[model samples]
Target: MARQLRERAEQHTETHLTLRDLRHVCWDPVPGAVVYVCENPRVVEAAADAGMDAGLVCTSGNATTVVHTLLTALVEGGTRLYVRGDFDWAGVAMVERLLTRYPAQPWRMSAADYEQQVERARDRRTPLQPLEGRPQTASWDPELAPSMNSFGMAVHEESALDLLVQDLRQRP
Candidate 1:
C-alpha cells in the first residue's frame, strides 16, 4: 500500500496532476494505517528512523495543498488517520482542519490522555496569552478541549510519544 501510494504520488508529480485530478483517485483501505501529522520535520524523520510501520505522512505544519491532496487520497482509500501535533492552539487547529477534511481517530489527544500526561509533566510551563479562540470538541473524544482548558497548559504530542508508540505497537 505504501509503495502504491508513493508511486501514485510520484506519478501525479511527474504528470503535474492538478489537485482536482488527484482527488478523484480512490485510495484502497489500509486497515490500521496511521498517518502522523506534525509541524516539525524531526518528528517525521524520527518516526521514519524508528521504522514505524504505519502509513506515515508528514504535514510539514499547516497542510500544504499537496498534503491536503495526499490526505484526501489516503482517506478515500480507507486509511484511518491518526494525528499528533504540538499541544498548542495551532496544533489543535491543525487537528481540527484534518478532522474536517478526513475521518480521523484522535491519537492520544483526549482529555483523559492529556490529564495523565499533565500529572507526569515536569518543568511545566504556563500557557501563553491570547487564549481567546474557542477549542473545538474532539470528534473522537469530546473531553479533550475542556481538559486542556482546565489544565492551563499545552502538552505537545511529542512529549507523549512513548505512550503513543506503545499504543501503536499494541494495535491489532
Candidate 2:
C-alpha cells in the first residue's frame, strides 16, 4: 500500500482514499518519514501541479472517517505528521482536535505565520472576511489564539499555497 501511494504521488495524481479502501490495508511508512495534512483540496492540487513527491493529504474541511483512518495508519507506523488549516475559528478547532488526538505538529499554523499572511493580504489588497463563530485556542502554540482574535480576519488555505508548496518541495 505504501508503494502504491508513492507511485500515485510520483505521477502527480491526487488519490482519494475512502474509509473502505483503508480499512484492510496497512500504511507502513518509512520510519520518521513526514506527511503533511491540510484542510483544503487546493493545497493538494497545488502540490500535484508542482510535482511534489512528499506525501500530502487533504481533509476537504473537517476530517471525515476516511481521513482519520488514513492518518491513524500512518501515525501508527511512526510517520511524522505536519498539519495546517485555514486561519479561522472553525479551522483552528479542527487543527486543535487533530493535534490533540494525534502526534502531529502544526505546519505553518502558528501566530507568526498568521501575522505574515495577514500582512500579505493587506499588501495585496485582498479582502479577508471577519472571523466568525467563537474563538478557538491553539494548544500547541500559546500565542496563536490571541494573535488570531486580535487580527479579526480569516485567512484561507489558498492564500498560503505558495508557501506550502515551497515547503513540500524542500522536504527530504
Candidate 3:
C-alpha cells in the first residue's frame, strides 16, 4: 500500500477579507430587498443553515471598520436592513448608533417581543445573564429599552433563533 501524504494549506494575511473580494462575486442589486442583520455571528450562521440567500449580514459584534464599509455598500445599493441585537444596554446603544448612519429597522426588538421571550426563557429555565450598564432609549421603539430594563435580563439573539428563522423563511 502506498502511503498518502496529507498537506494542510497555509493561510496568510491575504486570505482574509478585502475590498477586492466582493468585486468578483456578482450579487444582484436588489433595491429595497430585506437584508437580515444580526449583532452576533451565531444568529446569522443559523439563518445561513436555514438557506438564506444574499440578504443576510452579521456584524459579529460592534460595527468595526469593515462592518461600516459593508453596511454602507448594502444601504447604498438600497437594501432595507433589519437588525437585531442582544437585549442589553450595549445592544440598545448599538442600534442607536446604527440609526445615525443607516435607516435600519429593529427586527424582533421591542418591548412586547422581549417580554414574550423572557417568559418563554423563564418557563424553560434558560439561564439569563443580567443586563449590564445604564440603559439607553431605543429611538425606533421607545418602549423597548424601558421594557428590557424592567425585565432586568439579557435575552440574546440566540434565544430567539427559531422565531427569527421563521421570518427569514417566509416568502413575500
Highest lDDT: give the candidate number: 2
TM-score on alpha carbons, each prediction: 0.68, 0.94, 0.83
lDDT string, candidate 2, 1-172, tens digits: 6567668877999998877778656555678989999999999999999888788989999999899888888898889999999999999999999999899999999999999999998998988999999998899888998998898999999988899999998975
Candidates in descending lDDT order: 2, 3, 1
Candidate 1 residues 1-172, lDDT tens each? Answer: 4455567444432123456656665556676566655555555445545555544566767888987878776677667777766666677788777877778766667777777877756545433333346665666667778777887776655666666556655654
* Whole-model Cα lDDT of every candidate shown, in order: 0.63, 0.90, 0.74
Worst 10 residues of 2 by lDDT: 20-29
lDDT of 3 by residue, 53-99 (tens): 43566677788776777778778888888887888888878877887
Cα distance off (Å), candidate 2, residue 154:
0.3
Error of 1 at 92 (Å): 1.6
Candidate that would win on TM-score: 2
- Each candidate's root-mean-square deviation in Å? 5.7, 1.5, 7.8
Which residue pairs come into collision in candidate 3? none
Write the number of the candidate with greater lDDT, choosing between 2 and 3: 2
What clash pairs does model 1 have? 27-77, 28-77
